[model samples]
Target chain A: MGDSNVTRRSGKNQLLDLYLTFAKIGATTIGGGYAMLPVLQDEIVTKRGWATESEIMDYYAIGQCTPGIIAVNTSTFIGYRKAGILGGVLATLGFVTPSIIIITIIAFFLQNFAEYPVVQHAFNGIRACVCVLILDAVLKLGKKALTDYRCVLIFVAVLAAALFTPLSPVLFVILAGVAGVILMPRKKPEKTGDEKASDAGGKEGTS
Target chain B: MILLRLFWEFFKTGLFAVGGGLATLPFLYDMSARTGWFTTEEIADLLAVSESTPGAIGINMSTYAGVHTFGVIGGIIATLGLICPSIIVIIIISNVLKKFQDSKLVQKIFYGLRPASLGLIGAAGLGVAKIALLKTDVFQESGVLAQLFDWKCIILAVCIFFVYRKLKHSPIFYILAAAAVGIIFKL
Candidate 1:
């Protein structure tokens, strides 16, 4: 009983720490979820050693499958790992609370605010910046994902389908999964010790 | 009855929209077509507003659509419904993650998922391009030069691209800078 109690107490403390950590991530990261990657990697992997880089990448992949923001998914995964269900909730809340609060405040003033020249100009500029950020993310992810011909083929085919056809994004994702399943080399190439370490290291940088 | 239905539809949208907020666009397009909740033009406007705002694009659009459909309560309901799935999933996943942490199957599944995720992001880029680059009747019918293209957005895109390459600065800086240029040029 005493052991369980201590574990529970420690879990709660860990949850609190995760919440604070996510709050800091939320407050500092300028471009939201994708931009949060480097900072999250630093805090969760290098600084704290909460999860290895590969684990963080796994969380990111799973986050893509689930709803809400990627940042929220990541925070939930990390917090859950550290604590439990309550930790997941607290971490997600901490991550999203900043945007929610900021948006709510903006909502009050934005209707009329857009009419203002400065606000209009600012938004116009912001849109361009967002495009740049997204492009940067694409480039970064592409570098890691497109290491081989099969991956490149998937990227190009999917991009073409998305750009030309009126196919649903969900359908496209499903198709890619199907293709990956079919095309992935039969022998899962054994990773050398160095390769494994590098993979982990690459993940660590992004975690 | 209609309001409740609207809430449920948006709720489902929130539930299924994987990847990110942009993933909601295809669903929203279907919603507009099926229910006549809004028009394609309205969707464009919604996209513009959502892009400008400070929240997840999915949440922002949900709130906007809900408010348009009913009122503030509708907006709240839609937003709640969209986020509800994430809350539930996170709770469940958090509990079980450790047991599955090192599983090869999990790794394989994610390996497959990476390409799909990239595809989704790419699709989002295309969607944005369609809106930003392709000039429709609005620009075309106006005049010969207008029909050629909206050079302003194009120029802005190129200029920003170069600036991004040169400065390697955070997006906020570029956003602010582009907005300054837009206002100066009246674009």
Candidate 2:
């Protein structure tokens, strides 16, 4: 009974710590979740040592599959890993609170204020800049994604389909997923003794 | 009845909108087609406003749709409904995550998901490109080239690209700069 109580208390404390950490992440990180990647990496991996780099990458991957926001999904998974359901709840709430407050305030003014000429002009300019930001994200993500020939082919096919055909984006995504499953190279079996010996000899001089 | 229906509709949207907030676009477009609660033009406008605002695009669009459909109450219902799944799933996953943390199958599932997510992001990039580069009814109709291409937008895109590359500045800086240019150029 005493041990169980200690466990519960420790879990609660961990939840609180996770909430505070995520709240700081939400408040300070600018330019949305993608920009928050390095900070999340630093806090979760480098500092806390909660998850490794590959594990964080896995979170990013699964986060994309699920709904809401990538950052929220990541935070939820990490927080949950650390504590439990309560921790996940607290972490998500902390992440979204800022966005909620900001949006509500903007919504209040948006209807009437968006009509103003200056405001309209400002939005136009912002829209233009947003195109740049989106493009930058694409370029960066593309370099990471399109490392091999298969990925490059998929990229080209998707781009061509998007540009030329009236294909639905959703359909395209499903197709690409199918293609990835079908086309991704299988891991090869371990080489025979001779090949292993040659590989070791090749590496010996370089090292 | 109305509130329940509103909640269910948003719940469905949230459940299916994989990839991210922008993936909600096609679903919302389908909703507009079916219901006519809102027009395509309004949907486009909603996309613009939602993307520009300071919240998750999915939530903002849900709020817009809810407000359009059933006013303030609808907005709250829709928001709650949309978020419900995430809350529930996260809670459940949180409970079981530790046991499955090192599972190979789970790892492989996420590995497959990375490419899928990249594909969706690519598709979204294309959608935004269509809005940014293509001149629709927003510009006057003329020849095919004139109808499709907006030189002004292209110029702005190029300028912003170079500025972003050289300065490596924040998005807010670009937003402010673009606002200034819009006022000066009347674009």
Candidate 3:
């Protein structure tokens, strides 16, 4: 009984630590899920050692392929891995609570603020910058996505399809998956799923 | 009833919005056409707001959309609805997906998804570029070369794009700088 109680206390402490860490992350992650990459390396991998670097990349890919927000999904995956269902719940709540509170406050005043000139102008200037931010993100992701000559074909085809056609991006994503299964050269099977490829530059861990 | 519908709509969005945040743009457009809860122009604002804010852009926009149409309760319900799929899906995957995690097939699919996602982001970026730089309405209205684009916005966007290369700070920094410029220039 004493041992069980001790375990419970430590577990609670870990959960609390997890919550505080993610709360700060959710609050300050300016560029969204991808932005959380560097933070995760710092907090989760380097600081906490809760997950290995490759696992985070794998989880990121999983987060992307699965439904829901990638940030929420990845956080949940980490939370669940660390502390089971409740851990998952607390971590998510922690990650999103800032957004909820802030967005709620913004929503409360936004109706009134929407028509104000300074607010509108600020939004205008910010919108132009938002475009640049998106461009930056695309360029970064492009480096990862456009890794090879054969991949170039898939990249161009997908880009043109997304740009001009009526085809849904979702459909393109699915089709690309199929193409990947078929077209991407089948690398020799690594003996273990979790085996860290030593040559990997850890680019996935970087922002 | 509207809350329920908002929940259902966002639930569908969360279920299918593969890729990332901007991947939900098409779904948001669909919601606009089908429900008329928010207009296209309002969605543009939501996009900007979502991009600028902390947290996941997809959830922030959905929460904002719900609040815009339905209020605080709507925001809660919409957020819960959107994340439910993720929680459930991750729970299942975490438990059962270990064996299949390393298959060549899975790797290939992700191999495709990474660039496809980039391509999709590029397309979305172009859409934002149109909204930010081009005054398409003016082009349609006046058919004048000078009136085709907002020169100030274009210049500002170019400046931001280049400046971003040098000052790779947090997004909030650039956003605030632009806001300051906006207030100073009344952009």
Candidate 4:
């Protein structure tokens, strides 16, 4: 069961190294999920050799599809591959350490000074910018998600339902997933099978 | 007791906020409506804070929300609650379902989930737009149609959007510039 011979470091050191490396990645990455990819490629794939490029891509695809934060999920997958459960746990802990530390400090100051007029003005501007950011995110995601008429229909339906009803967003997600599973299979038997294959190849296979 | 509720609330958020960091916005909006722990305007601030910070926006947001509610300990609990699902789910997939990503079932679910996630995000975006771009409280008070709109913010948002379409700068730069505009123009 002892496979530490492949790496120069001892088992304990390897786990610690995994933690510290992810901590650095977490501490430095200023953006969101995809932004961390290049850093992961450099640190984990190239520098550490913990995972191959293709393997990293695979983790990212699965990570994006699954629940929770994409960055944290990718770290867990890589850490699990490198060491085991403990390694995965440590890597996740390391990745979140900087966030908790940094945000806690900032949150403290923000709470205390939020009443100041200068701070309020700054937040007012920042809030406007934040709206633009969200709209941009929606635009980017729409390009990927609304690939076809049916997908667009789903998007519209979901939007209407979510906005009009008091039903939980979670219900819509689950229902849409169920719709996908049921609806996608029907397209397979039609002449559109080739198109389905290509779409799947592009979206699911490579992503 | 409140700590448990916070953990449970965020745990649900982490589990269902499926697409990415901003996908969590819908859930956060729901939480604000339900709990009254933070206002809708505060969520826009949280987004700005999360975006400017050096970490996953999702983690930064949960930490900020937690700290707002119950201080450092609450931040810890909320963060732990958020990551708990990731650790367990990732470990399970790695151990048992090595080929999970390639499965047809998983692909189909993602196919449906993505668009729905987009809808949620778009809806959340509109919610924020109401707070940031519209002066609803002023409109209510003044009973004037002109007072319904914050022309400065609307102009700023339009300018920022067009500039972003052409230039494609980092979000931090836009945020900093917007803040400067707010300060100088008192927007």
Q: Which candidate should be chosen as best, given TM-score against the real structure? A: 3
Interface RMSD after interface superposition, model 3: 4.1
Quick one: best DockQ, which candidate?
A: 3
lDDT of 1 at A10: 76
Candidate 4, A1-207: lDDT as tens digits: 456565535887889999999998887555466546545645775567777543554465556667898888989999998889999999999999999999999888665444567766766776677677767766755664476887787789988997789776667877888887876645453334345445534543333
| Per-prediction tally of clashes | 6, 1, 0, 0
Give a tens-digit lDDT track for model 3, residues A161-196: 978997656678778888877877655434322232
Per-residue lDDT, model 4, residue A122, is 69
Chain A vs. true chain A, TM-score per candidate?
0.68, 0.55, 0.63, 0.52
Candidate achieving the largest lDDT: 4
Q: Per-residue CA lDDT of candidate 4, range B16-92, in tens?
A: 88766777899999999999888999899888778666689999999999998999999999989888898888898
Poorest 10 consecutive residues by lDDT, candidate 1 chain B: B125-134
lDDT tens per residue, model 1, B96-146: 655774565544454555665665555555455445544666666776655
Query: In model 4, what is the error at residue B126, expressed in angstroms?
Result: 1.7
- Name the docking class for model 3: acceptable
Off by over 4 Å in 2: A1-87, A94-99, A102-115, A162-178, A187-207, B1-9, B16-48, B65-77, B90-112, B138-140, B144-149
Docking class of 4: acceptable
Q: What is the C-alpha RMSD of each candidate to the true structure, in Å?
A: 5.8, 7.6, 5.4, 7.6
Clashing pairs in 2: A125-B178
Q: State the lDDT of candidate 1 residue by residue for A131-191, as single tens digits.
A: 5555655666677666578777877887787678876555666566677657666565334
In candidate 2, clashing pairs total 1
Q: Mark the regions of model 1 whose C-alpha exceeds 4 Å error after superposition.
A: A1-75, A78-84, A102-118, A188-197, A200-207, B1-13, B16-48, B64-78, B91-104, B129-139, B142-156, B162-169
Task: State each model's CA lDDT, in order.
Answer: 0.65, 0.62, 0.75, 0.77
